[model samples]
Target: MTQSKSIAILIADDDAEDRMLLREAMEENHLPNELFFVENGEELMDFLCHRGNYADKEGYPLPGLILLDLNMPKKDGREALKEIKEDVNLKHIPVVVLTTSKAEEDILKTYDLGVSSFITKPVTFASLVEMIKTLADYWFDLVELPKNPKL
Candidate 1:
């Protein structure tokens, strides 16, 4: 199924270079969905809960998908994933863990915390673009995501 163009994607990552690469990869894939970024998990929660700088709900619509990094400062992805799964309003959003770590513990932990999918960051830019394309195809064209109610 083709997803709505307005369905935003929220990405939580601390490394600026990684975020830039991800953005470039997404651009290479020519994804139609809107993309938003947060420096850390704190900002991610703020965006999701409409707190602090994210108070304007219209300006920051709830995302249909979230790409989270595991080892961010000031509340990591694991904590954020737990909170997202626990919250009734946010639990429906599909969260995919995209990080550099390949530790089995992190993988198992994130899965236990209710992450939809976990992908290790690819080493090459070309690979990243391919990964992004596959991800977009699966999430935006294949899967049926729940419609989020306007806040």
Candidate 2:
């Protein structure tokens, strides 16, 4: 595993338990990352653009990858995704929908919005660990992530 530069993972989820469980799974997978948390799409964008409370670069690192949930407060993932993909500055950052939504329409819409990948969240912690490992392997190890200028 690459150890020099820790990757940043931005996760937007309303559920606190889900966030804790996901963090535990990430720990189990031994994924070297700096995890950023946002409870809603609006916060996610604030973090991304370094606006408002997220303005400090030291406090909010730009995400190397984003794990987005479809349902959120303020702005939903659908709106946030469209905005991100449409903006050249934000579009370069890869987005992966890690959502609980199994709806085909949601899936199709997200893909059309230009998500790099999508995975439905599993029920079990062990399963989540496996999925996280696979995601890490594919995105961090296998795929050549976009080269974004460091903030």
Candidate 3:
């Protein structure tokens, strides 16, 4: 297994406000990690595959973790998660489903599709900040993540 010392997170979401809010949450909590954003699954795929507009390393380094939203244009998280988990080169990257949906079927399906965790997006900014902080504390500060093995 191999990996980078600097932790990186890729957030795939279509909502502009939500993206800004998430960034603010991390900033408020004093969380220091590289953050990448994609508005849709197609953009995310380009970023991950180093294709088209995302070919540069600064624009598209493989992320350590992915925070995915369920619904969006071009492609959705469910579709993206399935493709990612199926890809031999990309399957090892831990993905956490962060969405507004609390539907039981969505929850079960995401987990079954190999999402590492599933979290419902909270309404308030304060709650969301807490969520991100807790996630950072656990995933980055506490839990020992598997070293990304390059195939």
Q: Highest lDDT, which number? A: 1
- The most accurate candidate by TM-score is 1
lDDT per model vs. reference: 0.93, 0.88, 0.87
Structure candidate 1, residue pairs in collision: none
Per-residue C-alpha lDDT of model 3 across residues 14-100, encoded as one tens digit per residue: 999999999999888877778999999998888888789888866577888899999989999999999999988789888999999
lDDT string, candidate 2, 71-141, tens digits:
98899998999999997788988899988999999999999999988789999888999999888888888
How do all the candidates rank in terms of TM-score, highest first? 1, 2, 3
How far in Å is the alpha carbon of 9 misplaced in model 1?
0.5
Residue 79 C-alpha lDDT in model 2: 93
In candidate 1, position 65 carries an lDDT of 96
The estimated TM-scores of all candidates read 0.97, 0.95, 0.92
On TM-score, the stronger of 2 and 3 is 2
Query: Model 1 — which ten-residue stretch has the worst lDDT?
Result: 1-10
